[model samples]
Target: MSWSITLTVNGEPRRVELDDPRVTLLDLLRERLDLTGSKKGCDRGQCGACTVLLDGRRVNSCLALAISHDGAEVVTIEGLARDGALHPVQAAFIEHDAFQCGYCTPGQIMSAVGLIGEGQAGDDPERVREGMSGNLCRCAAYKGITEAVLEAQRRMGQDGWEEAA
Candidate 1:
């Protein structure tokens, strides 16, 4: 039986018909919607490679059933920017060299955005690292990642980042 799911993705409302209820949000976003920024690393929830903002919270898309999240607002890495400007996290990531292979950058950036939006990314680097522990980078860019989050949090504060959240 096909199921219909409506999602406001990256500020655009989209209604999709799911051929199978087992399809994960990641699959639906990538396969059906052509939003491929959220990667499928482990295909399990262990890795945050498929992280996305669901209803303003960071969720592992791989673990979320598309059919269950009808009417939810989802934000992927592709949606983090405006006209020609990068999101604070994305800009900070580049400034801090937070990515090496770039495979986990999307998830890392998304998680950072959510963390800052949640008001959890304080000035403490350790706290930022703890909050971002779910996302792992095989390239061992933890230092840069932590630095980027802290920097982005500070920048977001000055730029009125609440709307992006």
Candidate 2:
């Protein structure tokens, strides 16, 4: 029973045909759309490596079924750039050296973007840490990640970023 789903991906409209009810958004993004930036750290959603923006909110793609997101907007790491320019969050991550092995970078960036987009960027390190605790980096680059997100909030002129939680 194949079903059709239309979703805005990375600001682009995408229509896909899917049949398997068990097919998750992560699988569809990686296997079908070839958007492999989001990693599959833990398929059970324990790790935030599969994080993506669903309607401007952070969600674990691995835990979301493609069929369930029929008309939702999805933003992957590939969609973070515009006209050869990096997003502010991406630039901040690079500038802050927020990643080590880079495996968790995409997720971290996505999560950060969500936090900022939701007007949660703030100066409170503890709040930032608590909010970003879902995304784990095996390389233990947490300090850099926190710094990058905080810096991005500052660069974006986003108020209350210093008090996000």
Candidate 3:
């Protein structure tokens, strides 16, 4: 049986048909939607490579069923930029060298975005690290990731990004 789901992705409404209910959100985004930024690391929730924003909250898309998120709003790394300009978090990531292999960059960015939006990514480096602990970097890029999150938080604060809705 096929199940159809409607989701607002990257500020655009998308209606997707799922031939299998077991299809994960990560698969839906990468395979069907052509949004391959969210990687398939462990194919399990242990890795944050498939992190995405579901209704403004970060979730492991690999474990999220596409059919269960009907009418939900989803955002991937592709949606973080506007008019060819990078988002604050993306910019900070670049400035701070938050990535090495770049395979986990997209998920890290998305998780950072969601963290900042949730107002959990505070100014403290320890706090940022704690909040971002879920995202593992095989290259040991935690320092840069923490720095990026802190810097992004500062930049966003200056840019008048009030608490995320």
At residue 107, give the lDDT of candidate 2: 95
Between candidates 1 and 3, the one scoring higher on TM-score is 1
Off by over 4 Å in 3: 162-165
lDDT of each: 0.91, 0.87, 0.88
Per-residue lDDT for 1-165 in model 2, tens only? 889999898878899999778889999999989999999998998889999999879999999999999999999999888679788889998998899999999999999988877766477888889889899999999999999988988877853332111
Each model's TM-score?
0.97, 0.93, 0.95
Q: List the residue pairs that clash in candidate 2.
A: 121-161, 122-161, 122-162, 122-163, 123-161, 123-162, 123-163, 124-162
**Model 2 Cα RMSD, Å?**
3.7
> Top lDDT: which candidate number?
1
Task: Write the residue-wise lDDT of candidate 3 on 1-165 in tens digits.
Answer: 888899999889999998889999999999999999999999888869999999989999999999999999998998888779788899999999998999888889988988887786577788788888888899988899999999888899898754322
Highest TM-score: which candidate?
1
Pairwise lDDT winner, candidates 2 and 3: 3
* TM-score, model 3 to reference: 0.95
Off by over 4 Å in 1: none
